[model samples]
Target: MSADEDRDATAATPPELETDRELVAIVAVADNGVIGKDGDMPWHIPADLEHFKETTMDHPVIMGRVTYEGILETLGEPLPGRTTVVLTSRNLETPEGAVVAHGLADALEAAETAAREHHDGADRVFVAGGATVYEQLLPAVDRLIVTEVHREPEGDTFFPDWDRETWTETARDEREGFTFAEYVRS
Candidate 1:
């Protein structure tokens, strides 16, 4: 299928109005694309953690329901000035210091609106999530900032695979045990 066809098909596959908005997925994965295991990440690198925060701060971080819960438990609070957008089927009783969106399209729309309302131009929106959310948000992303961790851990949850040819590396940094790589869509 063509790009238009792919977008249309993806929009139709899910049962909601498609949102026309840009998004990005920021993640640190292993060489094998393994992200998490047993509902939590298995690695502990201060540099990786700092990179994640530094990249995602001042923007909206879109996530799936489970990812939202995991992030809430893991990160504890919203990153100072950023808005956390949780996409779920359930209508949340409270916002949990974050915004709640109904679906993938809705989540993108929410991010866009939040950016416009808060900032001057279209701001960065990071879909920091589980597999499903990443897959859904991948097509609309402007960049995919991937921190390629050195060791591959056994993971039940993995990052979606993409053609390396489709991305251009913007920056790269290496540490003792891991490497950080940023990819902008080409």
Candidate 2:
């Protein structure tokens, strides 16, 4: 189907729409498309970390189970200033101060509800991911806040390939180790 036809089909069963809400995907991908290795981020770019924090702060962040566990292991808690919604199928217990959903749609719904309640009118739900979560949500993402790492890093995990033609870069900033680019669906 054409893009408009695909969009029309999606619009038939839309998720609950808040007055001014958007679903944004936030990611940092190396030049070779790697986002993780051995269940963790392959690179250590402090500036990118800070950028991630600032961009997603005060919004609900939806991530996969592995990403949630990785954050807990590395940072010692769910991200501070954001409601975390973890997508998992193992029936594992939800982390303290986090919500769990079995699928992406449920997770997004949960995140939206959390944003409404805790963030006080914040309307962005950030898909802060592992590869699977990113791939699954790519089609529905309204905006992308991507940090494009300069080097190609070898890794087992990769960001899903997306159609560049569907998005238009609206902002860019050059940092030391990476370039941050923001894209809105065109």
Candidate 3:
């Protein structure tokens, strides 16, 4: 091809990736929509937790203040090997490593920056939620990595209601009591 043809090809954007950078939400939701009970996951599935860790390994993970606190209770620190961004409307003290955002816009902005600068220029940012955060960020989520638990457990918190038709299932892995599902917007 000619020089002009080469230049044109180089300038053209790839069609496969829908966005320059995607915002991803990762969560485990039971069949009845329960995600948590009193700030903690109602069901303890070690495999699901491992799935969460591997999928979000080097990305920036965003969550609500309460969710961050809940994580602190369990792990005693912000999640390791990833940037932690906490979104809250109130004045709260987080550990040294966590980034705090006062609103959704700030949270998203922080998440993107962290993904680029901190995680070896990652192309995706992750949202780890506590129901409210999930609800607020659903519209902007480009992809979802969900662990769909087969059984319904009692809980006070629930995952947000999302329109399934808007998403196309890209992959699925069936585990013993749960299925790891991935979806991208259609």
Candidate 4:
């Protein structure tokens, strides 16, 4: 190819790719949507654990630094097929298999890159987080898989608010100690 033709081609922006995969928010909360207490989960629902594992097995899961740390401690690190991105303002490094991002945008960029590199479009990039991370990506997430544990546990963290009119519940099933509900934007 001619140099001028090559230059023009390089300068032109390529058409954007429409991804079928969506950003998902996966959280376990009370009926009131309270998530955490004293930097930890307040409930001991084993069913919720299996549900979380099954849903996020091969996806890119995003979270705040503390949430990432908590998951590593509680769940014994993310599954082998998943990419974990942690958002933080502190100068912290990710563990061997994890990736570190400075903010929500950075995390999303990292997730997109991972999606392209991994070539897994059926899986989503999940924003699984602390309250601030949830609030930041709440408007952009396409699906919410929330496990509602019927309890009045005290919490310093809360889930983002969504209008019932705008979000439709796609699934509602009770398993042992919790009710798993999946919501999709309208």
lDDT by residue (tens digit), candidate 4, 7-106: 2211211222123458788999898789998778888777787788788886788888888888788668654677888888888766655788875567
Clashing pairs in 2: none
lDDT per residue as tens, model 1, 43-69: 888888888888877777888878777
Model 3: per-residue Cα lDDT over 35-119, one tens digit each? 9998899988998888889888988898998899998998999999988999887787777658999877777778778877888
> How well does each candidate superpose onto the true structure, as a TM-score?
0.83, 0.88, 0.87, 0.83
- Candidate 1 C-alpha error for residue 131, in Å: 1.1
Clashes of each: 0, 0, 0, 0
lDDT of each: 0.72, 0.81, 0.81, 0.75
- C-alpha RMSD between model 3 and the true structure: 10.1
> How would you encode candidate 2's per-residue C-alpha lDDT over 1-186 as one tens digit per residue?
122433321122244323246888899999999999999999998888898999888888999999999999988989988889988987877656688887666787788788888888687888888887876677677888999998888899998888777789999999887899999887
Write the number of the candidate with greater TM-score, choosing between 2 and 4. 2
Segments of candidate 3 deviating more than 4 angstroms = 1-20
From the highest TM-score down, the ranking of the candidates is 2, 3, 1, 4
Q: Which candidate, 2 or 3, has the higher lDDT?
A: 2
Predicted structure 4, TM vs. truth: 0.83
Worst 10 residues of 1 by lDDT: 8-17
TM-score: which candidate is best? 2
On TM-score, the stronger of 3 and 4 is 3
TM-score of candidate 2 to 2 decimals: 0.88
